[model samples]
Target: MNSRTKSINELILTAKRDGRSVKYVSDGYHTFDELYYHRMILFSVICHANKDRAWKSWLHDDGTIFNDTFIVGIQTDEGQYTYHYKTEYWDMFQVQEVPRAPKYDGHKPKDITRLLTL
Candidate 1:
């Protein structure tokens, strides 16, 4: 399939629907949704390398709290918004630096581990 034709949301949804294991990368983006007066927002879909679980992070510019996930990191104009999936639940944070991923175990594919580190 031509990945170039799909949006981040589409790619993630497709992967989930097909039961295919794949990761994603994007050069920061914004999407418009009518739910909040067509506000533009940023998000990321995190795929765990060795598990069937995935986490989604929604970066809220207005600091609106979404009760669904636990909050972490710093919420400020200068902080980076991050989301982490832990023990069956998702957590959100605004960080100065992206959280370090789990260390490589030498079992999963290199492509998956390459983007993750201790």
Candidate 2:
């Protein structure tokens, strides 16, 4: 099948209909299981990868698809906006738990401004 023909929403819906796993990746991404186990919010889909951007799935109650990549406030009814699914739609973004820095064990040495001191 031509993966490039499908959009992110199409891919997701197809997976849902066929009971298949949706393929996704990120700059620092783990498997779906890892995301689930780590407790993350699977929300909206976008074409761009912005570190500070977080999108939540917003579908129309009347079954309408809107291709808006630059959504204000990341509201609902925002379906897949990217044109190519093969290359662009694969990177899935979500809000996951970032690893915390190692706690300081009363070590009065080195730079205190450093976030991680292990």
lDDT of 1 by residue, 80-104 (tens): 2233223233322122222332222
**Which candidate number maximizes lDDT?**
1
- What digit string (tens of lDDT, one per residue) describes model 2 on residues 1-118? 4665466557668777998765453225686556643432222222123324333233232333255421111211322121111223223444221232122233232432221211
RMSD of 1: 15.6
Weakest 10 consecutive residues, lDDT, candidate 1?
Answer: 36-45
Tell me each candidate's TM-score: 0.22, 0.23
Q: Give candidate 2 misplaced runs (Cα > 4 Å).
A: 1-6, 23-28, 40-118
Model 1: lDDT to the true structure: 0.33
Clashing pairs in 2: 44-56, 44-57, 58-76, 58-77
Candidate 2 overall lDDT versus native:
0.33
